[model samples]
Target: MTLTFASPDQPAIALHVIDQDARDGWLEAQPPQVQAWVAANGFTGALGQVLLIPGADGAPDRALAGYGTTDRRARVRFPLAAAAEALPEGTYAIASGLPADRAEIEALGWLLTGYAFDRYATQSAAKARLVAPDGVNAARVEIMANAEALIRDLVNTPAADMGPDQLQAAAEALAGEFGAQFEVTRGDALLERNFPMIHAVGRAAEQAPRLIEMTWGTSGPKLTLVGKGVCFDTGGLDLKPAAAMGLMKKDMGGAANVLGLARMIMALDLPLQLRVLIPAVENAVAGNAFRPGDILTSRKGLTVEINNTDAEGRLVLADALALADEGAPDLVISMATLTGAARVAVGADLAPFYTDDDAAAQALSQAAFQAADPVWRMPFHTPYETLIEPGIADLDNAPAGGFAGSITAALFLRRFVENSRYMHFDIYSWQKAKEPGRSKGGLGQGPRALLTALPGMLDL
Candidate 1:
């Protein structure tokens, strides 16, 4: 769905945001007739409660949105979105009572509520539209909403239509739209280019595996994003059960989110050199599929023993991260739906990240709150480094015992990026259930927080 704020000069109904604590006082301040109307409708300002007060002409003159209590608001990321969804089809502007600090997030949430993935089946869009509130950056919020839509579209598409080739097309299209440079090293060329791990993990699929790269910006600190693009993972020779494979279409969520972040960076014209690397592949089972207990050499020349073929996301990311580290970018961040341990650790709503840079961590933590995107910082946990070190190879793709699974995965990816300041995100990129602004489908994690944190992290 296309999301845009109403024209600044357009006629709009006033929307008063009311919290439960101030409900009675707000009622006292209104005209007696309006107060009586609200009372008759039982408008107590409970969370998500919306009431419309009519004028003498029998038309809606103003609207009331319940901000509810702090505890009630704490349960969801975008509390105001509940009202946005419930409002009638008309342009509405916030007249008063919204906290200044919350205005931007609430406005963003309202825009996000417009999203609906109706690619295969018909889906209805939200009817209510919002005007950018005073003091909020409408352009930035719109950019974020559009980027988020791109991510959702890419992730929601099935693997048949979103394989390596299609993923390259999407990246190329994005680059074309922004005048960025785009290139892809596909099929056997990956082997010729020393990306053996990426090739090994994807050789069995009909669609050739590829390393998709895009570059933009000419000056300032360099930032490289490496995203795991396992388009669809059948777990290769170490196959997953039917239940586990059901959501394999979302395996490429990391790539989708990276593209979304790139869109925001380019559209906002951030003063930084940006490079994106995505290893797009489908881990399908076939006679040629890479198997367990097989040792493979990565682009960085580190040998990895495949203890579990299902652990392919980290394998592809390792090669891409090594390539990014070769450039020695100021910062290299790799995102992947790599481990189930992460989902179990923090649940689905919070993006779990690992970073050794305390300043970067601090910036991201603060930005997450401002962006209303939640994140939890996991550790590199140097002591657990030995867990990924198997006797036969430089590292074990899947460390036995399943203990510290997420940490071990991060430590494995870290081995290839020694020169750059690095961070890793083990994300569960699916929203298992619908919330206010977030739909129950493929989700974008960490990108919004990263966008807010970049200026501080890069000293821009």
Candidate 2:
């Protein structure tokens, strides 16, 4: 909740970023005292290396940061994070031989280093601040940083506090803030509303499952966002190992990320009509829990066989996608942490996205690199359609053989979405270790790339 953006044109301490090839020339132009300090410390301009120079009054002068050579292979991702995190709590300016987007990159890292999840703890975060770098829009950078922070906050909260009801409250509050319309279909109402698959997957838990819907923007092309809001996945009738259940709280991370993206779109006032749909549920075990071998009817009127109750996220998402497809929106994107195969295929950092639209796929590929967000476009392989088909039902919720699990799961969701230009992101959402700008907790994976690519795609 800190005001991270500042507008001071000049600052006392500055970070001069240099590459190894340009280090000697930059240092020779410096004052003799600074040259002596640099020699004393053996300051070779390696990536992430930091050097502190001394002033004439024996006080601290401007700092030095090393960005590697101009070669793409030598460059590091989020390189400014090290300098930003190491700096003390004061405003600083940026001086570097970076590309045209240098100002935006440095400002983003400055805000990222200040993030700390101290809700239940007594410790305060490091209060590092920076002046708005030249040529960068401070307001735009803050909008993106705040949205990413919101995603981490919602995903990091324990399931005991973040359940189906809390998820609905978050969406309602977001809609109210922007004057958007909001409604939730709860409990038995889901059955009456023709969302039978959603109701069956969540009826076991004490917290009645529901669908969270929000509508905004009165004009422009329509974009419908559907997120799998499985608040806590207990694996239902088929249980999981204790270690596997440890991070089930993060199953709702897709919902958190979609909400974050929605926040960014509204904050920027993009020229597009946006609607968010989340099927919030808790797949817990009870006496009346839906069992395996149960063939349930979906909102799309297709019957799905429950091969394993553990595969409940897709069931809830199927109904939501059906409702979104009914409107034939310009774009439909569904995000979920639904498969272990995705993590196995691309690891935790790189998420896999499936899309049948070639132009959107190309745009997302380009945006991922420019935005510094890692996402790979996996094929919506038509050949894998046989894997999702069971003998008895129109589709199988949990297909066996474990071959191409992620592809088969995507194919299963495609059955519910018939007409829209669809994209599905199978994300991990939780970071097991700390990276340059990301911490060892919940992280937003694919939203930044979409934010960068959407305006151009919609011709806004």
Candidate 3:
């Protein structure tokens, strides 16, 4: 559902943020009746708890939202978001208790909670809205929130509704909105473009395999982003278990995230030329499905032995990353739902990132902390590099030991990138449970951290 923001980003109501320890000082200064009512209600100012106070006339006067307790700390991931969701459906103005610099992320979090994948359902109620706070880039916050919502919507959609063609169309629509140049190489055209691995994996699906590309900005440092866009991974010829297949629609989360990041860059007009590449495909089973024993030559001409068909995300990404590396962009980062090993290590909330550049890695680490997007660095250890090099091919798509799956996958993609500073993010884009700001499905990992790191990375 589309959200509404107050024109001029003005406050329609007051939203007070407080912790139990500090609630007394603020409550003591309040009028006697409001204090009496709050005490009577037994509100302790727990995190995510919101209480609405009444005015003298019994009308809703203001909202009191709890920040976490001082002792335990908090995720603070959109700390103000719960307040926005619990407050009445209208614009809200947050009261002090947080830093002014955090206004954008906090406000953006509020905007995100209002998101619902309403494609199949009718509206039940109006969503609570927030007024842009002072010093907050209200327009930019809205743009980023909308872009995030777009990612969730795309990822949450089922394979029937969100195939390779639909993903290409979505990218085309985004390019049209930002005046970026859009192009796609579909079906056998992938072969013409020397993307044989991508073509091999996706050839069995009904929708033709394709690479979606968009370019924007002409000057400044080149920022090229690549994402794995497996629209639905049925594990190809190897197939997947029923439970594994259930969430397969979200396999293209990396694609949705990069597109969301592209949206943010274009909307904020970051001073860097940007190019986004998504190898959109559906790994379906058919007589022509690429076999597990099959050896395929990648765009970079490196032969990969298909140790398992389930490990197909890296195949398409290898071709796209090869193409991206050719541009010699200042930085080339790729994100993909590439391995279960990553999820097993970090769970769904934290995404694991791999980078050979120490300067970039340090910047991203600091940015991740500042932005509250969790990213842990996995080593691109040259020692384990041989794990991907099975005797039959230059690399093994699924190494036999089953050890260091994520690390090995990152090492595999590392070969495709020749010149640019490279970073690879293995993300579990699906949120199995609802959090304060994040909903229950389809999330963007690394993009926010990347956004936070870009200014320093690009020397902007």
Candidate 4:
């Protein structure tokens, strides 16, 4: 449902800012009865205390929310969002003059507080809804939230139901909804089309490997999004530990996120030619699974020696990215839950993106703030190019030493996109714990930031 700003006839709810150090001044400025009442009952501005002060006529005056010295950024977003949930069912504005950052933060908190990921659940009573401020974009906020929810739902589903065929179906459904052209290249046809790496990585599975492609819009800069759609990773012949395999169902999170972002782009009708490519595969272990030390030819004509079969995301992404780069799109971006080193560096909350274009990096950083989706820029150190060099083949899909795993993965994908200005995002698309907007489940990374910035990035 849409949210709006205050109406002309409606009464504006006052938000009185309270702090620990500035409580005395606020108390002194209050009326005699209110001051006496507050003094009688010890009231310090300790985070989230709500107190209603009565007038001399015995009526409620305003709502007082305590935010202990708003100098530091709170660890939990709960405090900033308390007003949205705690306040009475009515429109409220920030009555006090807050810092620009905090003001924007408060606005975001209000939007996040309204997020409900109950796609399959039955709707009941309406929860709290707030009006946007003077210049805030309510539609954009809701779009981002809805897109994230879509990604979460797709990733949360089990691998049994969300395999390669389901991945292609999801892409086809999105295409049908947006009236975008859709196609899939499956089975041995993958090999015929020079996607040998994709076939090699996924041929072991009962379901065939397929490339999911969708295109929309006709007259603007070409913006291509390539996502790694490893439906489930059994780690091929290499195999993963039982503990690590627990959350492997979320391996296709990158694909889900791309579709989520595409939903926003299509919904907004952004003036750009959008192309989405997802290489759908399931790295299941079987008798015919690709093994280590095997040489595989990629769509880009690069010979890659497989040092580890577990690093399969890049193999599927290589073919999709090659197809995207063939059109020489102005901007081609790819996202994948590709490496463990990225998780070690930034943890699960942040996605580390690699790009050689300075303008793209700046645009992404700005977009992250605009969309309330946080992403950090990681270096694409060109000197590390030699790390993936193989003695037998042109390149090694998995290097001997696993030093800079995330960086090497980005470099490997770079070999696929020769002409397009490309960027790669290494995301841990699962939240270990619950938070304000992000619940404890499969999380979407990089899409919000990418979706918000695409207009300016492509000069649309």
The lDDT values for all models are 0.93, 0.86, 0.87, 0.80
Candidate 2 residue-wise lDDT, 327-348, digit = tens: 9999999999999999999988
Q: How well does candidate 1 score on lDDT at residue 423?
A: 90
Error of 1 at 301 (Å): 0.6
Task: Indicate the residue-level lDDT of 278 in model 4.
Answer: 93
Clashes of each: 0, 0, 0, 0
Count clashing pairs, candidate 3. Answer: 0
lDDT tens digits, residues 127-221, model 4?
44445554556566566656766787789878998999988988898899889999899999998888898899999999998888899999889
- Pairs of residues clashing in candidate 2: none
Worst 10 residues of 3 by lDDT: 2-11
lDDT order, best first, reads 1, 3, 2, 4
RMSD (CA, Å), candidate 3 to true, equals 1.7
Q: Write the per-residue lDDT of candidate 3 for residues 56-93, one digit (tens) a residue.
A: 78867787877757653365577777666666676667
Question: Model 2, which residues run further than 4 Å from truth?
Answer: 9-11, 68-76
- Show model 3 residue runs off by greater than 4 Å: 8-11, 71-73, 123-126
Model 1: weakest 10-residue lDDT segment is 1-10
What TM-score quantifies how close candidate 4 is to the native fold?
A: 0.87
Q: Pick the candidate with the highest lDDT.
A: 1
